[model samples]
Target: MNINDLFLCPICRNIPLSERESFLNGLNYHLKTYKKGAFIARQEDPVEALYLLLSGSVKTEMISDAGTVLNIEIIKAPKPLAPAFLFAENNRFPVDVIALEACEVVFLPKKSVMLQLSSNEAFLRGYMAFNSNRTNFLSERIKLLSIKTIKGKLAQYILSRARGNYFTFEINQTQLAEYFGIARPSLARSLSEMLEDKIITFKKNEGEILNMNALKELVVS
Candidate 1:
């Protein structure tokens, strides 16, 4: 990806070409590519340059003491990784970022960030608005991860996407298992339990909610 691709990101949206060029010139930004399974940023790494994903996918993960890894988010291309952390007191990455596939990223130095923040009112406003949404997204993700049981996690996921009494899964079971931080067999077993309880019926990719109230109860209780 090239510098032109920066326009696709919300933070770079509507930024004037002259200001953009100056920002790039100040930092001497370069696009770097990483292969699959490469670590973009490790947990606790000091945050200096802001990384923007230009293409492919990256996963943010948190590893537990027991060696369990929970994938917190799968961020697709054409977006900034963590703009809010730029001004943080600790200024460190909280999660490990790895390339799920071949990917490209660009970074801008902290000096350039401060330069634009002080001079460009429009850019400053857009940057802040972008991080505000990020804060809310992180809050919701925290709630999702707080659910302890597999059934509860599955219930919350299903209810979030359910259209009335119907739900359809676009992702396959493997991806679902990875997202829920569970083994495929465990996910399959809990799903079978839901089927046995007659709370939901699913075949292939689509499912219909037979007992929405019961599914809701499963989430809270």
Candidate 2:
């Protein structure tokens, strides 16, 4: 990807050409490509640079002590990976990032990133907003993890993602189980139970909430 296109990314969105040129001046950056299933970065690796995904998608995941894989998030192209962690004290990746398809990434050194943050108000604000959104997402993840029962977790998941009475899943049940940190069978059973109880109707990736009140009760119960 051309360095000029980096300005199109959310962190640099709407930045004036003058400011963009100013941000790029003397900046040492590298672009690297990865094949599908390649590990872009390993867990606990030092975040020496800001990783900007220029193309393709990747999954952020962590393996549990019991050897279970937890799916953290799927990030698409044109976004920075863990923007908030770039300047963190520990400054290490919390999860492994693996490419879901052929991907191109630009690595901007910490110094360059800091320069952009200090020199461009727009870039700084965009960076802060991106991190704030990630914080909110983590808070919701924590809420889901706190729900002890599989049914309850599934209920909360459905409630959060549903649009009116209808919804569609981006990931399959296996991936959903990983996200919920539960056994696949457990999640499957809960879905079956919900269907049998007329609380929801799920088929393939699409679903409908048959009993919205029941789902609400399940979430709080």
Candidate 3:
């Protein structure tokens, strides 16, 4: 699909690129497809350019020194993938990006990125706004990780997503464990403990808050 014909991306959505012919001409962008489990970018690799998810999805994987692999987040299409580091001093990827399925990505070169920044005021503004939102997201993720107990982590996760006392987690137990960066047995044990303590009442995908005040206290303390 044509880059200018498309909505561009979240950064360029408000400021359409189709109208800016001169700005559009300065950069080169093309599509690339990757098979499932293929590494789009390895950990510690230099940030080459902006990547917009054209179709399908990808995940960010973080590995500890002890080889503990934690899958951080899944990014869906039409969104920029980790462009915050593109302008950093080191400008290296902190995680390994892997395609979850057969995915298509909009790959922009570094030269194009530089040219867009120099020539397009709207692109620059949009890029800055994107980075600012990314900062907030990272800050919240750090806060979630900082909670020491399993119950605390679970509580935070539910609280973050729940509209009321009721919330439905789409991921199964195994996926939940991986998302929480803990073992399956440990996650199950914690949930069981929470149930016994009357902190939450869960059945399969759906769960209701039994003691929201306690959960809130758990998150902060």
The root-mean-square deviation over C-alpha atoms between each candidate and the true structure, in angstroms, is 3.6, 3.0, 3.5
Clashing pairs in 1: none
**Which pairs clash in the backbone of model 2?**
none
The C-alpha stretches of model 2 lying farther than 4 A from their native spots are 16-19, 35-39, 61-74
Compared to the true structure, candidate 1 yields what TM-score?
0.74
Clashes in predicted model 1: 0
The global C-alpha lDDT for each of the candidates, from Candidate 1 onward, is: 0.85, 0.88, 0.82
**TM-score of model 3 (CA atoms):** 0.74
Tens digits of per-residue lDDT for model 2, 178-198: 778888998999999999999
lDDT for each residue of candidate 3 in 1-221, tens digit (9 for 90 to 100)? 55653355778776654647766667788788899999989989999888878777899988988999977888877788888878789999889999999888887888898888777778889888989988886787677778888888888988987878898987898977876668999989988888898988999789999898988887776
What residue runs in model 3 are displaced by over 4 Å at the alpha carbon?
Answer: 1-8, 16-23, 62-70, 115-122, 162-173, 203-206
For lDDT, candidate 2 versus 3, the one ahead is 2
Q: Candidates sorted by TM-score, descending order?
A: 2, 3, 1
Reference-based TM-score of each model? 0.74, 0.81, 0.74
Q: Enumerate clash totals for all models, in the order shown.
A: 0, 0, 0
lDDT of 1 at 141: 55
